[model samples]
Target: MIVITALLIVVVLTLAIYLFYHHQCRLREMAFLMGEAVRNGDFTFRMPRKRMFFGERALLKTLNDMENNIGRLTAQNEVESWEKLTRVLTHEINNATTPILSICQSYLASPSIKSSPYREGIEAIHDTTSSLNIFVDSYRKMTQIQKPDPVELNLLDFVSGVACMYPSVQWHIDISSAQTLFIDTNLLRQAFINIVKNAIEAGARNIGVRWNRQLCISNDGAPIAPENARNIFVPFFTTKSHGSGIGLPLSRQVLMMQGYDLSLAQMPQIGFHVTFIVSSTCGSC
Candidate 1:
C-alpha cells in the first residue's frame, strides 16, 4: 500500500512539471511571433487573450502598445506620401496655367487686339483666365505645406502683429498668462492668419482668440471629436468652398512637428474657438 501511494505521488508531480514546461514554451513562442510581426510591420497582429498565461500579460500589453505606435507611424507616412503627390501634380498644373494667363493678359492689353470684333472673346478669355488663376492658386496652397521652425514667442505680441496685418478684421485675444511659449513663429502666425481669414470669410464680425493650458476634453469628459471639429490637423479638409483646406492642417502639422498641440472647439455660448498648447519643455523648437 505504501509503495502504491508513493508511485501515485511521483506520477502527479511529473504531470504537473510537464504541464508547467509546456505553458512556458507556448508563452515564449507567442512572444517570438509577436516580435516577428512587429519587425515585419504587421501591426494588425493580436495575441489571443485566452492564450495569455501568468507572467506573460505584461509582455502582451507591451506588444500591443508597440503595435499601436507602429500603426500610427504607418498612417503618418501614408499621409506624407499623399501630400507629396498632390504637391507634384499641383506644380505641373500651375506651370501650364501660368503661361496661358500671361498670354491672355498680354493680348487684352494690346490696343489693336481690343479694337477688333473679337473684343468680346478677348474679355471672356480674360475673365476665364482670372477665374482659373484663382482656382489654381487655391489648389497650390493646399498642396505646398511648409515645415516650421519654432521659437519662444510672446503670444500677445504675435497676435497684435497679425491683427495689424489685417485692419479690416477685428481681433480679440485673451490670455491668462504672459509667459513666453516656444512655437514656430512663422507657422504659428500663418495658422492664426488662416483661422482669422476663415472667420472673416464666414462673416464673423467679432473674432476672438483665447489661449489656455489644459487638456482637451468634452463637456462629458471625453476626448473631443476630430471629425466634427474639422480636425484642422488633418490635411485636405476645408470648410470654405474657395479654401484649399490646407491652411489649418498645415498649421497644425507645423505646430505638432514643433512639439505642440492645436485644437478647435465650438460651444453654444462661445461659437468657434482655436486653441494651442505648448509643451512644458521645448524640444526641436
Candidate 2:
C-alpha cells in the first residue's frame, strides 16, 4: 500500500509539471506571433482564444484590441505625414513659380517683345505659367486649411441647408435639432460638401446621413473597389477622368486640423453601396 501511494503521487506531479510547461509554451508562441505582426505592420490578426486560461484569454483580448487601436493610430500618422509633405511642396512651388511668373510679365511688358518674333513664344510661356499657378492654388487649399473656430451649432439645420444645395437628390436626414456639435461651421460645411459632391459624382441619386457622435453619409452609387479604397485619401490620386483629385484630400486635411477624421468604412445598410464616416480622432465626440 505504501509503494502504491508513492507511485500515485509521482504520477500526479509529473502530469502537473508537463501541463505547466505546455501552457508556458503556448503563451510564448502567442507572444511571438503578436510581436512579429506588429513588427511587420500587420494589425489584422487576432490570437486564438480557445483553450486559453482565464488570464491568458484576457491578455489575448487586450492584445487584439490594442492591434485595432494601433492600426487607427498608424492611419492618422500617415494622414499627418502626407499633410506636412504637401505643405512643404506647395510652399516651394509657390516660391519658385512666383518669380518665374514675374519674369514672364516683365518680358511681356518690354518694348522689344512688340517687334520680336519671340512674342508668341513669350505669350505661350505666360499662358502656361498662369495655368500652372491656378492649378497650384487649388492644390494649396489642402495646405492652407483654417484653424477650427468651434461654436455651438445645430446639426439638423446645418444638414438641411446642405441638403437644399442638392435639390435633385433625395436626402434622408436622421439628425435632430437636439443633436449639436461645437465645431467650425464653415469648415465642416466645406468638408461635408466635398463628401456629398463625391457621392453625386459617383452617380448616387439617393443619399442618407445619420449622426450620433460621428457622422455617417451613405449613398447607393457604385461601391468602392476593395483595391482602391486604401488609396482614396492619397493626395492627387483619383480614378475619375476629370477629377481634380484634391477634394477628398482637402476634406481630410480640413477635418484633421479640426481634430476629426474621414474614412471609408463598411457600414451596415441594405441599399447604400458605400459609406463615408466622419469621426473624431481625439475620441472627444
Candidate 3:
C-alpha cells in the first residue's frame, strides 16, 4: 500500500509538469501569430479574450501598444507628405499665375490692342487665367479638407445624386443591392466626384462603380504595379499635367477618419480601378 501511494504521487507530479509546459507552448504560439499579423501591416488584429498567464497577458498588451504607435506614426507621415506637396504646388501655381496676370495686364493697358493678333493673344491669356484658377481651386480644396458629420444614408440614393450632378459624364454603377451605410454624405460625395473627374481626365469614357458585401477581400486582391500602387494614396502625385494631385489622397483621408480604407487596382484590360472598404462596426456609422 505504501509503494502504490508513492507511485501515484510521482505520476501526479509528472502530469502537472507536462500541463504547465503545454500551456506555455500555446501562449508562445499565440504571440508568434500576433507578431506575424503586425509584420504584415495588419494593425486591426485582436488578441483572444481568454484568460492567459500573467506573462502572456503582458506580452499581448505590449503588442497592442506597438500596433497603436505604428498607426499613429503612419498617419503623421501621410499628413507631413501632404503639407510638403501643398507647399511645392502653391509655389509653382503662384509663379505661373503671376506671369500670366502680368502679361494680361500689359495687353489690356495697350491702347493699340485692337488687331486680330492682339485679340488672339488676349484669348490665350484668358485661357491661362482659367487654368490658373482651376489649379488654385484644387490646392484650396486639398488644404481645407474638413471632417464630415456622418449620418446613415442609402448608398444608391447618394450615388444617384452625384451622378445627376454630372450629366455630361457617363457613370456605370452596378450597385443593385439596397445597402444603407453611415457616412459623411457630403464628404463621400466629394470623394466620388473627384474620382470620377480623374477618370474622365484619364480619357475614360465609361466609369464603373460597384459595391459588394465582400469588399474587404476584394480591396486586398486588386492588382496594381507595386511601385505606382504604393504612392497612389500619397498627396500631389498625378499623371495629369494640370492635376493638383490631392483628390485621391484627400478621399483616402476622409475615409480613414471614419475607420475605412481605400485601395487601387490596375486592370490591364480595363485600366485602373479604385475600391473602398468600410469596416463592419463602422458600417452603420
Worst 10 residues of 2 by lDDT: 276-285
Error of model 1, residue 139, in angstroms: 5.1
Q: Candidate 2, residue 108: CA error in Å? A: 2.0
Worst 10 residues of 1 by lDDT: 214-223
> lDDT per model, in order?
0.60, 0.81, 0.64
- Of 2 and 3, the candidate ranking higher by TM-score: 2
Clashing pairs in 3: 182-285
Residues 1-285, candidate 2: write the lDDT tens digits. 999999999999999999999988988988898788777555545589899889888888877777767765876677678778878887888888888889889998999987899989988988898888788788767767777899988988999999999998999999977988778999999989998999998999999999866788899888888678778878888999989877887787777676677777644355799888877665222
For residues 104-149, write the lDDT of model 1, one tens digit per residue.
7888789988889877887887788778768666755545557666
Ten-residue segment with the worst summed lDDT in candidate 3?
A: 214-223
Q: What is the TM-score of each candidate against the true structure?
A: 0.48, 0.74, 0.53
Candidate 3: segments with Cα more than 4 A from true spot: 1-69, 80-92, 112-130, 154-181, 192-222, 239-244, 256-275, 280-285
lDDT of 3 by residue, 45-142 (tens): 55664678787777677666666556545754686577677867777888778877778777776777756477777868867887776767667666
lDDT of candidate 2 vs native?
Answer: 0.81
The TM-score that candidate 2 achieves is: 0.74
* Candidate 1 vs candidate 3, TM-score winner: 3
